[model samples]
Target: MKRIIYYLTALVFACIHFVSCSDDEVEGTQALSVASFYPTIVMEGTEVTITGTAMGSVKEVVFPGGIAVSNVTCIDDRTLAVTAPAGVSEAESALVLRSENDEVASRQTIRKANPAFLSYQFADKEGAMTGSSMTINGKDLLLVEDVVFTLGDDVVSVNALEMTRKSNTAIKLVVPKDAPIGEGVQMAMSFKNNTSMTLPAIDIQKGSGGGSWVQKEVPVYSGEPVDAGSWSGSVQLAATLFADAKVDDVIRVYISDCGSNPQGSLKNGSTWVGLTDDLEYFNIGDDAANGYYERAITEEMLSQMQESGLIVAGQNYVIQKVSLFTAVWVEGGDEETTDPITPETIMLNDFEDHDGHNSSWDASWTDAEATEFPVDDNGNVYLRLAKPLDGWAINCNHQDIGTVANIENYVIKFDIKIEAGVTGASEAAMQFVLADNWLWVGAGLFPETTDGKWMTVSRNISDLSAELVGDLAIGKASNGLYGGVIPAGVCIDNLRLDPKK
Candidate 1:
């Protein structure tokens, strides 16, 4: 019995050696092979078959984890159909085939899910009207089957055209033609995966702030002479200064008149207009006890005066402090012009402040202050330069500040700040600019002198141009001679462009 056992063991060893040799000869190459894998493929309910070659007769094949395999049909000895497990991952799987001798295996890629319709649509503001072509930005949009879009929730009738997936992230679609223009209506988009996305509806108002930016309205009357009708009763009064203005332009306000003798008044009992806040009550026919005097108006006083009827139009007014005038004045010196009514008394502050400097001050080595564009409780702006600087030359050939237009009786106004206690003012004169056209070479005050106080400076644009519409460039030296810097450090502010009456 021992001899028989030894012989049987030797036979078993020989069989094993034969199998090993065969495997070594066919290293790395499976007798049967799976061609390729359908990566990223989605499976709904699709059948898959394995294809390869087998050396011996093939029997039944099994899938991974002992799942029942069906629809098995051998082509010859190798290629056959083995049922793929439904709802399994579309990835690598082991296939065991029972051959005539033993079982062999090769990996087959199984696709449990096939690419299907998700959802897609334009991402527009909710309540957006129809014909809105909004960008449909999303994911899983690659290789999309179809995209359905509609105005409302009902998807029965899709008004949207098929979306051509530009990439995995974006698609383009339009709001349906029949979309409503009111609220509560939404835009729905469906992707090939049967997934849907909706955008909130927006009201179809004309200007419902439908922009992506904040709105900013420029301040109109940044600084105009305090008017008699200063009290509009509302904190936000509708100002007339900036109804028509250009950017980077300065504006000014000057007090025109104080009560003249024989205090003028209509039966309305309105007091005369004054540059100052101090008021005097007098009998109808008598000169008020105090002679023509000076009275100052603090910001608080101005508010109080606004509340009283003393600030009505055409009232005889006086200057509390030496005051300035309105910014939109005529050309040339505000030299006392006849008060259209008096025709004798010169209206010192008649012209609006848009006018350029009233005079010029050359460094004759002799000059004075409060002469050209005078300032009281304020400083005057002077647009002077040493020489030609880069990107700073006076230009009036283009639109905006650089172009020349038909300007008639227009004025230019600007403000300046002087350091407190400064004594001497600068020789930097404001120009009645007329670039490319006949330049108004400091027609008014040259090197305009001031009291070294923060104030406003204005010039009549009409003095520089005959055209009713003309552009004004402020700072420029026509002579090309370099001038020394004016000791008075002045800051320019709020340049303006106003129409002249």
Candidate 2:
């Protein structure tokens, strides 16, 4: 009976040992399987919790871009934590996990995070103004799909055509005029195939203000005419205002032929009739004072009037009553300040009209040939210089400045673009000459290498004395002489004289 009891005990112990060994072998051979990961889409350095079976022995976690994840920790048999790696390419990639003897991977890709919001501002100013260009700077900006602005009840969406992708770090766009004005205006940017984030509120100021018009009529002519060799005319027209005028408020001068008995009322139908359709309005700019305005009746203005049949050249006409009209901004309205009108450019020749020749510019050549031609089907014109035997000269006469006794307050400016890959010349030079008694000369040399870009050349003649008027001449020179064989050509435009501001 004792022997049988001992044998039974030994058998029971063996069974217990066998069961323990089977359990250990099953645990050691368990196949790794990933169920899912929390927050699958994460930014760089974001901690992720991966839940699955057989994750206790996780030795490595590989993120997108084949980058090894850092700060990995295996919590237990079913949970693991890891920090997403940085420098991942912009795409969805598989998340890989490795153990001592086996590896497991999630079927779902780990997507790269959306672009992070930083800041934005106008390109030229500290704050964005209506119609101003704005730039947004941030990290991973290339992922951005669209940008929108919230203005009161209105939602302004930036058009793709208006937005310029400057680079991966910057985007440029124009601020819509209807953008809400006040503090805490919200802006949001969205990314392609990803979530969007809202930036902090921005302050928007009142971009425009209101004003009233006060008009005063003055004489027709300001000074006597002087002979400018080519043309002569008396400059005139000055008006006054009672109110403090804003920069955008313009003083309009209306004229009528004699015997019209025109009333100068702003609303009278007869007054509108008197201001004929041919010569309807003359916009005069504001002077230094808010109440002062002036419009010099230049020779060009006279020519325009004559062409419009409002007046006859070399014919005397009676002076009718002159009326002044001013358009003022209204408060709390949609009216915006008009862009300040640039002063009238004398001797302006953009080559857009008259076959690349203006009334004031006369083409003269010495050792080169020039032709006025349009660059494209758009009718954009330019003066093309080609096949230069030596060099060329073009003369422009500014009657208004030449006629003035003191011609010391003008600037001559023009644009030049040399063709790329121009060869056969050691150097090319440009020479400017003011050829009468008040002689002035200036020259600019082109570098041996050029990128075929347009450059503006300007010379101020403020200090030169004006005893007599002469022609303004421009020419190209090579090796101290006016002539050379040009393999590639050049384009010239926007030749004009501006009053020194």
Candidate 3:
């Protein structure tokens, strides 16, 4: 019995010793240590390798800002790898390595990457002229400290006041007037600590013209229209030729309004009287060019001006005189030229002869409540538009008056006024359309005047002859109403087609 008991005790002791050895083998005995890490600076999502002992027991790696790295793998007991978490802060942060039972930290701190260049574009993405507003779209724009434009050796530094940071993705700037004008201009941005890659080339258009040229003012009239018999019969108007004038060079003749008297001294306030057929450039050596051009002044021309408010029949008078100016196009000379005016004034409509009939006037509306016909009070007639819908109200008239045949020689003028408490007032526009040809010209009225006062709007249709060959209709261009934010009521009067002056 004693022998059996001693043997059992020995067996139990042996079993206990074997179990203790197995448990020791399962728990790691190596101490965690970090010798070093590669890439002291790291961008988000970059894989980092740590060379140290007992790395296989690492549970997780923590970066600054509570960012925990995922997909950690232990290559061996001495090397560990993990994908860096997306950095949330711009500052540098210490790295923390956590094991199942211990933790180790690195002395070095990793920082978020600096801004990187991707691409850029103008606000319109098409291009911009100098002095025009432009927008740049790119990444990390918030860190941009300064933007520089480069064209060969010439550089333009944008004024600090000119740049506006709209967002992290967009910056607004005005194309500086001195910015180099050419294709493939380089743009670059500098950050607090780094500079971005230069953007692909961009195009900037030429700005307004700047230069000098010669100007000569030829006398339009030395005497009165009546003295020249221009009021009743054909009159001869002439100007002396310049010595250096070329045969092919252009000579534009203009008439001046010698308010009240023939000998009124030419001054800044002197008005140039424009007549029909005046804007046409006459070759310096052309018809009867014998140092002069003759125009027939008849009763018809005088009557037309009297009817239109251009000249008061008895109170105001037009001299049978014109001023001639000459210009020649040189390879690198100024390209800007002014058109001459000829006086062939005609009154298409004064709203005085409505006669209670639509009488050559038609009212059209879109999303409008009502259209008021021409109302006359003491010879002053006006057309009123009320409750215009999203689209504007237009009062157009078509006449077989042969005006459209030579539309280039004429201009349309009218008085427009916005009524108080009107909606979509700023969105109101004026348009002249030729229905037969479907050609139309329109402009916004709000830009010139914002108050409710009456304002005269004039447009030269000289270049629109091809489009104005059909019956003419004048009204508001169809602009989508701003959800009824603009005034809805307006007044229009004195719609007329007068010879360009």
Candidate 4:
């Protein structure tokens, strides 16, 4: 995440500007005319009103670059109101109002206001945690072409993946951990005119978000695939399966060929005729695809499972392999982008927040939920995609800042929770990519990680050309035939770009 901010080009203000409209009344039987919109300085995306005779006939508003916009609204016969667009070239220019037969021009040179800094707020805390969001408010911020954090001698601009222009008045970015903790840390905004302004220097504080991670995989059972003899019959895993596990540990039961609905209970010493199936009972979703069930170990659950492990009984299901994950949290902190030794990064989407970047895809078919993307009860949203199926492609639009044509030292990071029970439960190819171009990172580039837990996969992308790559895509990477691969409920989240560690 260090030196990660020097690659942005500029932010696009999204429109051609300097058009004006007003609501002043026009007298009857008057020639088609318009009054010069006052306060010639206008902000992008703000309403600009112009009062004119025959405004009811105005069909279009012409902005700078001769960009004609027909989305103007007629407030009344004598008044027209249209949102000001982002002006690219002519700072001060004449705006044209076009009707069916004639054109009316603004009597004044309406100019788009430069981005003016107002104030700034760190995350909802006294000091900003690394990976926490900070917002800067200003006027005409839509015209802010570039934003950088000046930490000491470094002028850092995050790639398009992290920064977001929320509205004309606000832009938000995630704080990086690479800065030395102290004062004189400044945020600067640059505009098209080659001018820039800086906010007041503030104290840079370190946050304790991410930390060192250590993982352990606990296998329950493994064998050739076998079908359940009956819908109500039970398959009992030995108590030793969880003998080495502890309370507060998270375990994922990997059941091979989990046909559809499955149910189970924590038994005491392999009792088939159960005493009572109460709180010990569990249900697996009707999943013809996924083969794993996740659970956090508790005092009572651990005590119950210690006797006979688990008894799973369900209809039409196959049992080939079974395993449990013993995930431990050794909390040093968010070690990836938030550790002091790591480089700075622009956070794309944690899915905890519905980031605008997620919607930047040309066509979003990420998951097939009933109506919308699934947000879990824990507030985690997911890109539930299949392997080698590269449909989860995010555009390389760096918050209107610039492309991600970056140093070879930069890496892309994302969190993937693999359901290893689902036959071919492994990540295929995740790439710093552009469609079927096969131009960037290759297949199996992820770190050696086990399934059933969220593993942060960081892949170096030095192998690709430094051209303006347009997107970052993920797919199964196997084209011809998916022998036994079915990745239905695989989850992806917290994607971003940062300098490689």
Output the number of the lDDT-best candidate.
4
Off by over 4 Å in 1: 1-31, 37-40, 47-68, 72-85, 90-146, 149-161, 166-501
Ranked candidates, highest lDDT first = 4, 3, 2, 1
How many clashes (backbone N, Cα, C below 3 Å) per candidate? Answer: 83, 4, 23, 29
127-228 in candidate 4: lDDT tens per residue? Answer: 655545677877766555566777767666653334532346677656655644667777677654456677777676776762332334444554454465
Q: After superposition, how far is residue 428 of candidate 2 from its true place, in Å?
A: 2.8
Sliding window of 10 residues with minimal summed lDDT for model 4: 476-485
Which run of 10 residues does model 1 get worst, by summed lDDT?
1-10
lDDT for each residue of candidate 3 in 1-501, tens digit (9 for 90 to 100): 000000000000111111111112222767777777755545565567776667766777887677876457654455567766675456777778787678888877765655555545443345766655566666555545567888999898763333532335666655666888898888877653344556667788875533212222333333454321223222233212324332222232222232332221111111223334431222222211111233333233333323331211111223333333322221212221212112223334433321122322445444434546544322235556555544434433432222222345466655566665555555544345433333234335443333555555666765545544322332222211122222446666544455553
Relative to the true structure, candidate 2 reaches a TM of 0.31
lDDT of 1: 0.32
For residues 263-302, could you state the per-residue lDDT of candidate 2 as single tens digits? 1111112222212333332221211111122233333333
Model 2: weakest 10-residue lDDT segment is: 1-10
Which candidate has the highest TM-score of all? 4
Better of 1 and 3 by TM-score: 3
What's model 2's overall lDDT?
A: 0.44
